[model samples]
Target: MEEKLIELVADVLEAEPGALSLDTEFKTDEFDWDSMKGYAILVTLEDEFGASITVDDFIAAKRVGDLLGLVSE
Candidate 1:
């Protein structure tokens, strides 16, 4: 899930996968991340992990690990 989420972050933010890590703050670490990117990640996460995520949940996420935690929950 970590690897897949890293790849999705890169795809949505147009970043290099190598630039991200398990602890990467997906929202703040990247200059280009926006609400739209958050939305994209929400949908992709649902598709990939079968997790039900809300806007508030996505907005509450501060890091990539938050996402992993969310889906795992």
Candidate 2:
């Protein structure tokens, strides 16, 4: 499950499949992550994992693993 979440984050971030680690920060401006990408990630996660995540979840998520934890729960 964590692997899938990592894959999703990598895909959305346009990074290497293995580049996203559990402790990867999602809010770094250096990564160029924006609201549109964040929304896309939320939609993709819900569609792929059948989890009802909201924008608030994205806002609350500080790292890739944080979102994964929410899905796991």
Candidate 3:
């Protein structure tokens, strides 16, 4: 599950899959994540995980790990 989540985030962020860690910040300076990419991520996660995530979830998610935790719940 963690591996799949990491791949999804890395694909969306255009980063090397191996470069992403659970602690990586989605909106940090090192990553170029923007609002558009963020929404894309939300949609992708919902579709892939069969989960319904609200806009508030995206708004509150500060990192890929945050989203992972949300969907896992």
Q: Give the TM-score of each candidate.
A: 0.86, 0.89, 0.88
The candidate maximizing TM-score is 2
Give Cα distance to truth, residue 64, candidate 1, Å: 0.6
Model 1 agreement with the true structure over 1-73: per-residue lDDT tens digits? 7898889877887888998887888886444777787888888889888989877877888878888887887
The backbone clash count of each candidate, in order, is 0, 0, 0
Model 1 ranges off by over 4 Å: none
* Residue 63, model 3: Cα distance from true site in angstroms: 2.5
Which prediction has the highest lDDT against the true structure?
2
Candidate 3 collision pairs: none
lDDT of 3 by residue, 1-73 (tens): 8889989988988889999888778776677768888888888888889878888877988766888887787
Q: Is candidate 1 or candidate 2 better by lDDT?
A: 2
lDDT of each: 0.81, 0.83, 0.83
Q: For model 1, which pairs clash?
A: none
Report residue 12 deviation for candidate 1 (angstroms). Answer: 0.8
Ranking by TM-score: 2, 3, 1
